[model samples]
Target: MSGSSKVKDGVSGLEFKISQISKNPPSLLVTLKNNNPSLPFTILKWNTPLDPQATNLGLFKLVDEETGKEIPMDGLKVNRLIPPSKEDLVTVAPGTEEAHEIVMNKPWLPEKRPASYNVTVSGKFSGVWEKYGDDLQASDLEAYLDSPFSGKSFTSNEVSMRVE
Candidate 1:
């Protein structure tokens, strides 16, 4: 390791906040054409790339933009990786970009109300360790990750309008 590499092992964590919502973003747009409220909206997340050997991590949180309430993890119906069985893997190199798409399942929310969502980084290492998968087998480790690493607060977006 001679030259300065912008890529660091700790870089695999998400320091920035994550919020996915369009201001006046067409929350109520429908795929039916001339329809009200979109049937199913999705949440997309890009975490710092990391190896797949890390501990239990990865899951974007959902919050009510207005109520400041933390939505249940169940509502987050999608994931990037489901470890222990082998799967989720990304590198935390300079340009490494890991992503996750979570579908919003708040059917109880009014079809035309304002809401917001914020992403939560659930690990100390940004879960971006490039050697996570390999590390899974290794006994020696050198890092500390607190539970519930990072979280962005509720933002503001709207649901589709009622189709009359």
Candidate 2:
């Protein structure tokens, strides 16, 4: 996965892969793996914007490869730009991986969509900075705590899946 910036932490070292979990419900499994040894990295949960961990959880879009048209995704809400309240960190140990399975239901991907479509996820992983200022409280620090000092932006390779 390529990022917007260059980071040395394991965040940039994450490897992404997508698979077709099921064709009946139209689901996809997205996995993030930490390829760096001796360096532990955290990824943001489903919400919270602009932080290191948060950067890794991105949005998914479907593209019709046959017609070159973009499919409208419904039921998928946009990310809220709320202030960081709690720290939802997923730590991946060296050579470990985490998977998120997405079920494409109505609005998100209608039950009757085209057969040839490619799924792409837009986002990146980030490395944490070593220094933390005293003025920042724990919650405040949560926003910048694992802030991306250097990292890469990620755009997943399109994985083709079809509806049964």
What shift in Å separates residue 73 of candidate 2 from its native position after superposition? Answer: 3.5
* Worst-scoring 10-residue span by lDDT in model 1: 27-36
Q: Cα lDDT of all candidates, in order?
A: 0.28, 0.55
Report clashes for each candidate as comma-separated counts.
Answer: 15, 12
**Cα lDDT for residue 64, model 1?**
55
- Name model 1 segments beyond 4 Å from true: 1-17, 21-63, 69-85, 106-112, 117-164
Per-candidate TM equals 0.33, 0.66
Over 1-164, each residue of candidate 1 has an lDDT whose tens digit, in order, gives 11111213222222222333334432221110111122221111223212222112233334555566765533222353322222433322233323332233334433544544433333223222223344433221212122122222222122222111
| Tens digits of lDDT, candidate 2, 1-164 | 22322333334566666777888778777777667766665554443222333223335667777778887643334464444334444556777877777676644454555476777665543334322232234663346434754344555556887877
Q: Name the candidate that leads on TM-score.
A: 2
